[model samples]
Target: MRIKRLVQKHPEEKTFWKNDQWFNVYVQVNEEKRPDYKSRLYGEFDRFGFEAEDKYASLAEDDEHNGWRLFRRFKMVLHNNKRLTKDVTVKDFCGKQMTAFPLFVMSIKYLREHLLQAVTTQKIGIEETDILYVLTVPAIWDDNAKRFMRDAAVDADIDPARLKLALEPECASIWCETLGTDVKGAVAIAGSQYMVVDLGGGTADVSVHERKPDGSLKEIMKASGGPWGGIFVDENYMKLLDRLYGEEALTDLRKTEMSDYFDIIREFEHKKRTVDIKNTKHVIVRLSVSLRDLANKYSKQSLEERIAALDSHKNAITPKGKDKLKVDWTVIQSWFKIPIDLLIQHIKTLLAEPKMKRVQTVILVGGFGESQYVQDRIRKEIPDDLKYTYGTNVFQYFDENKYPDDKKVWENGKWQVPFCFKVYVRVNEQVKVDQQMTKRSTPNSKISLTAVYRTTQEHPKYITDPGCELLGTIELENSTDIPFEQQRLETTFMFGDTELFVKTKNKTTGKEAYMTFECFT
Candidate 1:
């Protein structure tokens, strides 16, 4: 007998909503409480609308941190008036039954508007012409994902054309580049060879890179992803709580007084992210309050007596959100063993493979990579002979894709050099070249200087394309010759390797050109 499972097709261009105005939109969704949160919440996003601001706020903080003084103010407003939920929602604000997406979208919308304001004033780093990259989960990808992205992008004042949506796996490559690790043919070097394991709340992604002598690095990025990271552990903690306190107890608390239950759960999550012990104690109290309130409503016991009973079972009622936590450390360690073991097994297999046996080091990165438990487990599993490095703040380099050849050189020195020099372009043989192209230009028009391109000997690895050399920038000796609008020097560096032609345009509009002597390897 043959069996069939359901499959969904990805959405095409119509997935995005359109208006008369032009805008670039980029959106990515992840599971709110899980890795698959964004997928489950897609339909709801249509009814409630996307909020780019909240997503930005959520991203700014690790988790549980609502942004800053602004967040505190918003929290107060939401707390004082539950009707604020109704204001934000198109439908009735049903307590406990309320979905997480609406709030998430609202937050994103708020954050994006704030960011837009700053951008208008030229306060933020994100420029009007910059393309926005929205991070999302791998599970809920398809037409729905595209729609959500476009919705969010439009709200963020970004043009949909300029917006690029990518999964975390693909973003890992960008992260490497943002950190100045992206290079061509870099895997051959010793210091440059290492795996980038991005273990975050909902997923874990891995990539490998090698450094090149020309100050660049190359990466071995994987294509597959799965549900393996922090959210699963959080679910485990929830299950444990349900087992001890009785699921009914939580149901009652959420139904009658959701804020109370949400407060406790939210605080517990905050503690987990912060690793704060005092917060853990508060979680115990919060849970105890719920238990006491439920007991008071059902039994003849006094609130004080119910509270006492809760304290007694506190050992069994584990708090995962905001507290130092009450669960056995050994149990927590064992709970994570499954995913940890999987990672270890994969690493072991990769190392055992004949091609990877020579590998000497591993680099740990991402949100979950910061977990003390994960670090300890990796340390205990790997051989002492192999080296390890942790990317303490990988998010800081999340946007890095343009990598120089040398990591050490880029990290240590901030020297300016003429990058346009040695840059080269190959014009199509069929393409016409005007030898006196500059002569036709106006007096204030830009002209190309003597281009200095990389020699085959200087970048041997890049010799795959023999004619592809580095191209240089044009220089105007006379200051008055440069016009205000023409101050920008634009040149297209052409390159081709028989099959296809490639061109890289360099626009030096406002920044001064760097002067440095050329060096050969």
Candidate 2:
């Protein structure tokens, strides 16, 4: 298939609406009703949208959280711990809490319920298994992370067979397929290659794709990204607050009026994105009255005096009328500098690769991608090789072609299914990458089930043998409504990279379905 499958995800907004109205994912659990964030009691959760995300600080400091601690950025376990087993219990950063898993389950359930509710409201009947629930994750996430996400979906009452984990950057680019090549100085169209930089809240996923002659985009370079996201800017802004507000006062406010504290931060959040590269005027932000009062109570100094005490060349933060603070453009720019620098550096290295050389348009997509400051910095800092205007003009979308380089070896179209089922890798098997991915193709009258197994004994004959254990199943259904002769399944088992990507296309319908298989080695 020339183009990858077009699964979907969020665009460059708090929640970009796919079908008319936006379905928000920022879930705010009613901590008042349930003190436990890890409660498995699904469908009882509250709103999860921008308002909930903005209220995260407040939720973290609720009175009920006195004994337990709140954890953020809990997704890093997959990357940090390479020895992590699928069944191993995941703990918090301090290795104490078992809360992240259940939290994930709750979030997934809430999302599913909301989606179902939206459909039901329109008087539409949808089967749970027939509807493939797509969950987009950072491309930097490895196999373990993918497994964790899949397990969470399973726990959320979703069938793993119907679940599809879409890479975040690919989701962004695939969503842009309809962004026709009508823009000025356009290079992205049918057959041209481009790069997708998905800058989300905490991670930036980068990938390159080429539009095939059949209108399907093929992945040239797999996923490469880092933790250089927009949240880093928010962190720097917090550091600035700690320095200016006095850590004691800030800490006290976080303990007492966290909602106000979050609002204070969100005030800067709103202002930061608006400040552009050419912005020369001071960005004005309305300060929370509680913050200003607490600053004086704890610091024993007024806001004006604190500004005066700074030894810098110019005052980055200035006191405006009563509660408003006029922040310098320089300060906002500095907050954006480090993360954007790291992100651009990563892009430069990605572009330097042989396969990546043909990439012309660098489409920036995500919530962070909406930042005028981030976009402006990318335009100025990155090399001229990325000349096309990102996020503004070039947004292409389509089905994502993952593991595009996995070549399928078909032998004379004679017999592949019968042999594939009987194929075996000896215990302590030592075979090349090419051998593992090779499989023959033939039309089947019925669906085929390719079961993967792991055995303890060196020579185990059947799955019912003493040491053999069923690990996973890869199923191939007819690609489209077609005759047995018109169907062809391009099956491949890619190992060593830690997963299996199976591609099948119906010759008559020209439809393709991707199946990913994950199992214990």
The prediction achieving the highest TM-score against the true structure is: 2
Residue 54, candidate 1: Cα error in Å is 12
lDDT of 2 at 282: 69
lDDT of 1 by residue, 94-186 (tens): 221232223445555555666678777876576656746463434223445445545655654556666666655445544555553323223
- What is candidate 2's lDDT per residue for 434-463, written digit by digit as tens? 234444455555564555655555544335
What lDDT is reached at residue 411 by model 1? 20
- Which one is best on lDDT? 2
Model 2, residue 301: C-alpha shift (Å) = 2.8
